[model samples]
Target: MSLREACESGKFVVTAEVAPGKGTDVEHLLKDAAIIKDRVDAINVTDLQSSVMRLGSMAFCHLLTDMGIDPVFQVTCRDRNCLALQSDLLSAWALGIRNVLALTGDHPKLGDHPTARPVFELDSVTLLDVIGKLNSGVDMVGNELKGAPDLFPGAVVNPGADNEAAMDLQIMKMEKKIEAGAKFFQTQGVYDLDAFEKFMKRIEGFKAKVFGGIILLKSVGMARFMNKNVAGVFVPEPLIQEIKDAEDKVQASMNIAVRLVKGMKDLCDGVHMMTLGWESKIPGILDEVGL
Candidate 1:
């Protein structure tokens, strides 16, 4: 079944992300895809995730589709203008790629190539508005399109933002995205269940499907790095202590991920695991959680 159908069925859906390598070698990519293909309802192909230059997300999605895996093509606005974005969306639709996750993308400075020019022709909110217009048989500027795309578009949310008012800001953004034609939302990595619960309480009236984000940390250093460098993501001291005290960082990381998933099972419609480079451990994480 399609990711849309799986999510709308009220089932506890599971999705994972795959970051294509910088080069053309897709051996590890395919292996990771195969590992989670059966366990996840859909797979997200990250578009140059974290501003690190890599293979294109659309090509990765097409490859996943060929492997019989449903892929959510993650489109970022950092590198493309409306014209290019629309052109790629048309290509994705023509190639049978249905699921799309629109993002404003990380600033070029955060990526590997810091000198690259940043493109902010449109933010995510504007992108969603464009998608809605396209669905209605028109482009962003009200130009008529030869055909409309039947895209199951989704958007991102940062549930871990530190500001007391950040949650409200996020909910407001979500409402706008929904009005602009977003059907589902997958959040940034969430480590605090209390924060996430609070965010959900504020948006209980929205009709969009929400999938909590879970990132698997390989070590305490990694967790610390995220806590410090990644905005809108906070790792509680207790989790940090747990990681610091563990004898085996890898096993401890997996244990923490499983616990997070188990705790979030009843709180949200689904979980989107961002395993990063540790994608191989996903099966073990799912097995531990009995998912």
Candidate 2:
């Protein structure tokens, strides 16, 4: 069954992501995906992740579909205008991809190509709105279409916001995205389970299906980097110290991920894994967590 069907059936879903490289060879991406294909409900294809130029998300999603895997085709508004965005959605549907994750991508300045122009023609909310329109047998302007896409659209969320005000804004955006037709959400990496639990409790009324995000803590440095640079992601110092003190760092990282997954058992609809480059270790994490 597709990821949408899995979630609708009240199954606690599991999802992961795979990013395309700047160059043409996809052998590595495919091999990694094939390793964890059966373990994940769906695999998200990143769109020029971090705003760095890379192989197309749509193309890789198509490849996943051809390989009999369900792919969450990520569409970032930072690279495409509305016209192009709608066009690409239809193209993706024609290519047999159903799941989509809408994102307002990072700025090009944060990427390898700082001089490239950025396009914020539509943010995540607006993009979700456009997807709704497409599903309803029309384009963004209310024009009729010969064929409309039956896309299972999802969006991102940041549960570990820095402050109360930021958390409030995140909730507001989550509601707005729901109104705009977001059926599910995959949040940013979270470490503090108590804070994440509090955030989940506040949104209990929405009845939304949220997949709590998990990033394997590779090292103390990685945890610190995410905390200092990434917005809405806070890695508590205790967890950092645990990584720093570990003699077997890889096993320690897997154990940390296992704990995070176990913590979300009663809170979220599922968990979304963003393992960075540690994709092959997912099975071990899942097995350890008894998922």
Candidate 3:
């Protein structure tokens, strides 16, 4: 089923991330996509995730669709200006990619190519508004379009933000995205259920589906690195210790994901599993969670 259908059905949905390789070679990525095709409601193709350069999100998304997998093409504002952004949206629709995830993207300074120039002409909120305009059969400047694509747009939120003020800012931004036509949300990595539950309560009235982001922790060191560098991501002390004490780090990570996804079944509509290099482990997690 399509991602939109899965969300509208009110059944617990499952999605996974597929960050394409930096080069043109996609043999490994295609293999990974094939393994998880039947397990997920959709696969999110990241757009230069972390601001590091890679194959274009739109191209990989099309590749996934041709391989009989559903893709939520990620659009980042850091690389494209308004003209390029709108053009890509139309092109994506022509290619039969309807699901989209809008992100402001990471700063270039934080990526591998720090010397590269960054573009922030449009943030995530404005991108949602652009999608809304396109869906209405119009361009950004009010020009009529030949046809409007029925795009199911989504945005990201950071429910696991550290400070109360930062968390409040995230909710306020989420409200704006919803108003701008965000149909769903895929949140930042979630490690604390209590914090996530509180976030859900705060936004209980908003009419949007929430898919908790689950980034499988491979080791205590990995968790620590994210806590130090990644914004709005914190790996609790207990979880870190659990992985540190486990006999098999990979299996421990999978078990941790299964437990978290099971617990989140009642709190959110679905999960956006982000396994990065561990894409092969997603089918195992889904099977164990009985999805």
| RMSD to truth, every model | 1.4, 0.9, 0.9
lDDT of 3 at 168: 84
Point out the higher-scoring one by lDDT: 1 or 2: 2
Candidate 2's displacement at residue 183, Å, is 0.5
lDDT of each: 0.89, 0.92, 0.92
User: What is the per-residue lDDT of model 3 for residues 168-266, given as tens digits with 9 covering 90 to 100?
Assistant: 899899999999999999989998888889989999989899999999998888999999999989999999998999999899889889988988998
Cα deviation at 143, candidate 2, in Å, is 0.7
Looking at model 2, report the run of 10 residues with the lowest lDDT sum: 199-208
| Residue pairs clashing, model 1 | none
Where model 3 places Cα greater than 4 Å from the true spot, the runs are none
Assess every candidate by TM-score: 0.96, 0.98, 0.98
Q: Candidate 2, residues 65-84: lDDT per residue as tens digits?
A: 98899999999999899999
